[model samples]
Target chain A: MILGVDPGLTRCGVGVIEAGANRRLSFIHVDVVRSDPHMSQDLRLLAIYNGLAAKIEEFAPDTVSIERVFAQENRNTVLGTAQAAGMAMLAAAQRNIPVALHTPTESKMAITGNGKAGKIQMERMVARLLNLNTLPTPADAADALAIAICHALRPAGALEGGEREQHLTPAQRQWAQAAQRANHGRGVKRGM
Target chain B: MILGVDPGLTRCGVGVIEAGANRRLSFIHVDVVRSDPHMSQDLRLLAIYNGLAAKIEEFAPDTVSIERVFAQENRNTVLGTAQAAGMAMLAAAQRNIPVALHTPTESKMAITGNGKAGKIQMERMVARLLNLNTLPTPADAADALAIAICHALRPAGALEGGEREQHLTPAQRQWAQAAQRANHGRGVKRGM
Candidate 1:
C-alpha cells in the first residue's frame, strides 16, 4: 500500500492505494486535511503535522508519495506550499517511511499518459484508473490519489532522474534503505 | 534567557540573552545552525529541525525571538527561509515556549536606534550593547542577537501593530496563551 500526500497549508490531500498483480490498483482511502487560513502559521503547520502523523500511524503505508514543489508564480502560495511539504516530509521521515517525490508533470504523465495533462483530465483519469464511480471532492483528494497511483505504477528509481531528483538528501536515501529492509519480510511487495 | 533565531535554510543564526534589571541585556550565547545546500531538500530541513530542537532542549530559554520573513527579490531564497522559519517556530511551539517575532526594521531600530541601519552598523551596535570584546562572526549570528535583544526590550503586544501583524494565525494565538500560562510561575518574567 502507498500513501500519497498533496501538501498545502489550506488543504492537504491524502490518499491510500494498493497495487495488486498485473498492475491493478485499488483505492483504500482518500481525504483532505485542512487548516483554517485565520490560524497562526506555525499552528496551521502543527495541525498538518499532527493530521498526517495520525493517518500514517493508522494506515501504515509501505511508502509515501508526495508532490514535489517547484518555482511558482505566486510567492506567498509557494512559501505556504514549501512549509507544508517540509512538514509532510518530516512526518514520513520520523516514521522511517520511504518517500518518493513526483513532480506534477511526472504524476500527470504516469496517470494520464500525458506530461501536460490538465487538472480535469488528471482527475478523470485517476477515477477511471481507480475504478471509482464518482470523482473525489475538494479536488485535492483526487490529486493525491493520482500521486499514489503514479508511484504505484512506477518502477523503483524511476523518479531519480528529474529536477525532483535533486531533492533526494542523504538522510532520505538512508530511510529508503531502512524501509526497504523493513518491507522485505512482508507478503505485500511494494511496487517501488 | 531568550533565544533569538534568524531563520534561513543555509545559515540559521541563533543567540541567547538575559534581560537584566533596568533594561541592561546580557548576552549568553550565539551560534549558527546550517544545512548544506547540496543535500536533499528534505534532509536539509530535517537537519535544521534537529539542530533547533537540540538547542531549545539544552538552553531551556524562557522565550524565542525570530525574524519575520518577508518577500524577497529571490523567490527561491524566500521559500527556503519560510520553511526554515516554520521549523524554528515549530521547535519553540513544541516546547511550549512563547515566541516573539520582530521585523528586520524593528530589530535594527532596537539595536542601533535607526530603522534603516546597515549591516555593519547593526553588528557594531549589537557588539556594543552586549559588551562583546570582538564582533560576532558570520553576520547572521549578530542579526540574531539583535532580534533577541529587541524582544527583550519591547513590551508584550508590541509586534501586533505592524504589517507583520497580518500573518498571525489562530494556532499562534493559542500557543501564545499557553506560553503565557507556562511563564506566569517562572521568576524570569518574559520581556514580551
Candidate 2:
C-alpha cells in the first residue's frame, strides 16, 4: 500500500492507493486528520499523530509517504507547521514504518502528467485515476491520495516491504533509521 | 560547530556559531540566501537547496539546526514554504548529519527564560548570551543562531551520530515509509 501525506498544521490531506497498469489503483482509503490550531503546539502535534495512528492501525499499510517540511513567509507560522510535520514523521517513525518524502511537483506530475497542473486539474485526475465519478471531498485529502499513488508507482525497491517494525535491536534500528532518513527523498545528489 | 538555518524563499537566513564552553557564540559567520519568487517552484527549491549546501560547505559545521516550517492563512504561501523546508532537510540529510528542528516557543525559551517571550526579550537574551553590545542585525540571523543553541541544549538524539554508519546495510535503507496515505495536520485533520 502507498500512503500519501499532504502535511500542514491547519489541514493535512492524506490519500492512499496502489497505482498500477492503465492508472489502476487499489482503493485502501483517504482521510484527513486535523488538529485545532487554537490549542497548544504540542496538543496539535499530538492530535495529528494520534488521529493518523488510528487510521494507520486500520489500514495497516507497509509504508508512509509525506511531503518534507516546507519553509514559508510568516516565520512563526512556519515554525509551528514544521513542528507539526516532525510530529507526524515521528508518529510513523515510532511505529517503525518506512516513510518516503516527495515534493508537490513529483506528486502533481505523477497524478496529472504535468508538474504545473492546477488544483482543479489534480482533483479531476485524482477522481479519474481512482475510478470515482464525483471528485473526492476536501481537496487536501484527494491530493494526498495522489501523492500516495505516486509513491506506489515509484521505481522498484523504493518501498521494499515488511522490514520496519518495533522491537529491533537498538543498534539495528539506528542503522535502519539512518538509511531511511537518508533515502526519504529521491533525486538529490549523493551529498550537499 | 553549530549551523543555524532560518529558511525562506526570498531570503533564507543562515548563522554559524562555534559555541565553546563558557564563551558566548560570537557570530562565526552570517549569510543570507536570496531566491526569486518569480521563478518556477522547482527552480526555487533548487535555489534553496544549493544555497544551503554552499553555505554549509563554506562553514563546515558538525551540526545543523533549523527553525521549523510553518504555514500562513494563504494556501499558495503554505505550498511554497513546504517545498523550501523539504529542500533544507534534503541538504542537511545528505551529510549524514541530523537536522535539529526547533519550534518558536523553544526558540524563544532558549533565548529567554519565558516560553511566551517577545521579540525584544529574545533580542535582549541573545545579546546577553552572546555578550553583544546590541541586538544582532537581520533579526532572522540572530533567531537562527539562537535556535542552534536551543538544539544543543534541548535534545541530542535528533541527528544520528557518525559512529553508526558501519552498522547499516544497503538493503535496509528503504524502511520507515508509511504505505497508508492519509492527510493529517493540525487544525486540518478531519474530513477525508
Show where candidate 2 strays beyond 4 Å: A19-23, A72-76, A155-192, B1-192
In candidate 1, which residue pairs clash? A39-B169, A39-B170, A40-B169, A40-B170, A169-B40
Query: What CAPRI grade goes to candidate 2?
Result: incorrect
Cα lDDT of model 2 by residue, A88-185, tens digit: 55456556666677667666655665668899998887787678888888987987887787665443323254443343333324433444654676
TM-score of chain A of 2: 0.75
In model 1, state the lDDT of residue B186.
68
- Model 2 residue B37 distance off true place after TM-score fit, in angstroms: 29
List DockQ, one per candidate, in order. 0.25, 0.05
Give Cα distance to truth, residue B164, candidate 1, Å: 24
Q: Summarize candidate 1's per-residue lDDT along A120-141 as a digit string, tens digits.
A: 8888888887899988767999
Q: Which portion of correct inter-chain contacts appears in model 1?
A: 0.39
lDDT of each residue in B1-192, candidate 1, tens digit only: 889999999999999998766457788998999999886666788889999988889899998888887665466687788889888878887887878777887676566556688998888878887899888888889988988987875534423344433333333234334445555766424322
Poorest 10 consecutive residues of model 2 chain A by lDDT? A163-172
